[model samples]
Target chain A: MTPLRHVFFVSDGTGITAETLGHTLLTQFEAVEFKTTTLPFVNSPEKARSTLDFINFIAKDAGLRPLIFSTTVNDEVRAILRTADALFLDLFDLMIHTIELELGVASTHAQGRAHGMANQQKYNSRISAMNYAMEHDDGQSTRDLARADVILIAPSRCGKTPTSLYLALQHGLFATNFPLTEDDLEQQKLPSSLRGLENKCFGLTSEPERLSQIRSERRPGSKYASLAQCAYELRQAEQLYRRAQVPFLNSANMSIEEIATMVMQEKNLRKPTF
Target chain B: MTPLRHVFFVSDGTGITAETLGHTLLTQFEAVEFKTTTLPFVNSPEKARSTLDFINFIAKDAGLRPLIFSTTVNDEVRAILRTADALFLDLFDLMIHTIELELGVASTHAQGRAHGMANQQKYNSRISAMNYAMEHDDGQSTRDLARADVILIAPSRCGKTPTSLYLALQHGLFATNFPLTEDDLEQQKLPSSLRGLENKCFGLTSEPERLSQIRSERRPGSKYASLAQCAYELRQAEQLYRRAQVPFLNSANMSIEEIATMVMQEKNLRKPTF
Candidate 1:
């Protein structure tokens, strides 16, 4: 049996970037089991040394060399962390050096700039986008449908709300979602509020079984959660999407991230620049 | 003046991981300006070749090498992209190779696994947490506050809502936020509903000037948006936090990510494991 390998994501900031990249890399090695930990806000040499000690202790306890993925930008703290007895992958140091050589410029090596509120304008806009999404969620307010970058249309519980919130919070896009009611689906047309916004409308459909299962968790044993009703609603929603020329995707097997990415690409929505 | 460098994030999936890490790396070089683009869903060799052509064209047009940060896991596609006329940084290839050697096992080299829905249970919980956050936003409903992993409290416009949603969506934590009302501040006590949940509570406070500025955008030329009102409210909230012994932070300058990470750490909230 393969032993569980220990991995550490160490960063001077929130360590989210290191953890994100590290998780993606670890997912590639499916045969190996990994126990991962994140050490964030390790901005000082003292903190770095203690983190190193903790990592070494874990290595000794696990009887394996732990893999360390670090993004610490402070020179002194990074130097301290580099002395650990493991495969220390310095994410920032090597890449920053290469980019510096290529650009003929030296790096500032500043810490906490990656996720800090450095650009107030962009930060404020991101918050505003989140507000926009919350206000417009589930067709709550169609008063400003014209302001939406993309409007997701789907039957209830087909994964519209999460995708809308993800787009707004992650990319600062003005996204909104609307649930297609039985009347709209039976008519096989876009909702009245989305009449002229077909260009910005994206539809999501799910497998009948999946939709029924999700709805069952909300309202058990109801016709709304029945497989027959779900299948009918999805079939009608797809027909409406085709008639309206709205791009759509099946959310049965896709994550919200994947769904959001495809919607953004299909609608030519650009992520807001900081 | 520094010449602008073009950077591309190429991936077989959503390319969010590539863009996120690449953005962090580029932020270290404060002197250089970057014009970045993301090419997501590049899962084929044909797509890789076309992406290479695009990167090379930009390199030629700019008279400088364009930087390519890629997370494509397919061998054929990655090989084709490696031939681009730029500084090609393959995020997965080198790290996976090293990890494979360390573990003495071959990587699956699977495409689209980074952000795919490989784990349905975790995905469902994340969606549930998002719904919980939305239901409990701004103290909208406290019916299930007992199930929340953390509760964030602050006066209006102190950034409680966005932080709560981010905590739920990103970390899969059941998070709820309450906007401290004038009555609660005047009484200098926790809300009646939050009386027994002090251990699970975290307070957020913002600078008076910043709070007033944020409120001014929402309700211009109103007493609620006045600097004096903002100062008084913040002071009362902080005192309430101290008296109730709820851990808190000043959110005036911190990004939502920073604030979320700090709250998680302080509250000892472990990110849900898949």
Candidate 2:
């Protein structure tokens, strides 16, 4: 039987950074099964002690020393958590010292700074980008289409909306998506709303089988969910993209992260500075 | 003048894991200015060499040793990146060895597994959650409100939409948001669509001034953007939350990430296993 390990992502902030790095590290070890939990905002000595007790209890119950991925920046809190009966890997402690030495400066050791609302302008821009994506979603309105950093074009159910939202939310990019309609595809040209914006447009296509499956969940046994219809739309969309010289991607097997990254790279879109 | 540093987040996959950790770490050092860039999909020795070259060029141009936080899992690529004229910090290499020793196993050393579509079911769930958030945004449709893991309720500009979308996108939570209308606030009752789901509802309130400022950007010089209106709505919303026994938070000073994390923690909502 494969051994099971309990992993905890402990941080003084959102714990997102710890969880993200921990998950990425754990994915490399395919032989071990991990049961993971995130304990965020552990900024105080009291919370740190309780967290230690919980980890020690879990270690004793599981009969294995649990693994901890922590990013605590407080010296007092870090001291409290250092005694956990686990493989305590304080991520910040492990690297901050070296960074301090290299840069000849001391870390502030402040808690909850990683994901706080410290930069109001960046936060507002992020929210604005999200609102832009929402307003321009599925070509709902072309009122401010030219203001977009990138516009994703795809056939319906080909993974445009999620990618658009991810770009806006993650990168603070003014992203919009438009679903290719039959009229646009039949004409073998870009959508009327996207005629002169070919340079700012990116297209997404998916395998017919995958597209059909996705559409079937939304509207079962309908022409829109038919494989033939999906294939026809995809072919026409690809042709339109080629004729318009808009960079495109096949998103059948790509996650939204991958698609968003590819689109940003292809379009040379830099995230709005935060 | 604060010292300026060039930092690179280099990775074999989407580089998000690298950038996330690097950013979190850099936030601790407020005395330095960091000019950051991300180089993703550096899975090959060729790409790694080019990455090294770029770092070297930047270091030479800026007359400072660049900081490279890398997560490349391939030995060949890591070897190439190790030769860069910078402070090379391989995140995976630093920690993967310890983890392997603890697990009594060798890592897969796979590239691009962190954010790829290795698990299709999880990807599908994330997409589905995003779609649910969109379909139920601002109480657009309450058809499947019961299916939501958590419902966010707030005034129109109190930040319900971004929080809802973040919860769905980041954590794969079935999150729906409802903008509390004037009638709902005056009645001091939950939305009729959310009457039975109070336990699953989380309220968000902001400072009156902050709320007014945000609304003013949307509809300038309107009653909705007035300080009196914002204060009245917030007071009523807080009363409604207390009366209904629903948990709430003040989001005036919290980022969407912070808001989502707090909601997940308060509601005891676990991210669906991927």
lDDT of 2 at A98: 85
**Runs in model 2 with CA error above 4 Å?**
A272-274, B272-274
Model 2 residue A116 CA deviation (Å) reads 1.2
Q: Write the per-residue lDDT of candidate 2 for residues A222-249, one digit (tens) a residue.
A: 9999999999999999998898888999
For model 1, which pairs clash? none
Q: When superposed on Cα atoms, how far off is each prediction in RMSD?
A: 1.3, 1.2
For candidate 1, lDDT tens digit of each residue in B78-127? 88998888998888765877877887888888888878997999999999
Indicate the docking level reached by candidate 1: medium
* Per-residue accuracy of model 1 over A1-274 as CA lDDT, tens digit each: 6788888989999988888888888887777778888889999999998998999888889888999888899989989988887888878765877878888988888888888897898889889999999999999998878999999999999999999999999889999999999999998878898888898899999999999999999999999999999999999999999989999999999998999889988888876343
Question: Pairs clashing in candidate 2?
Answer: none
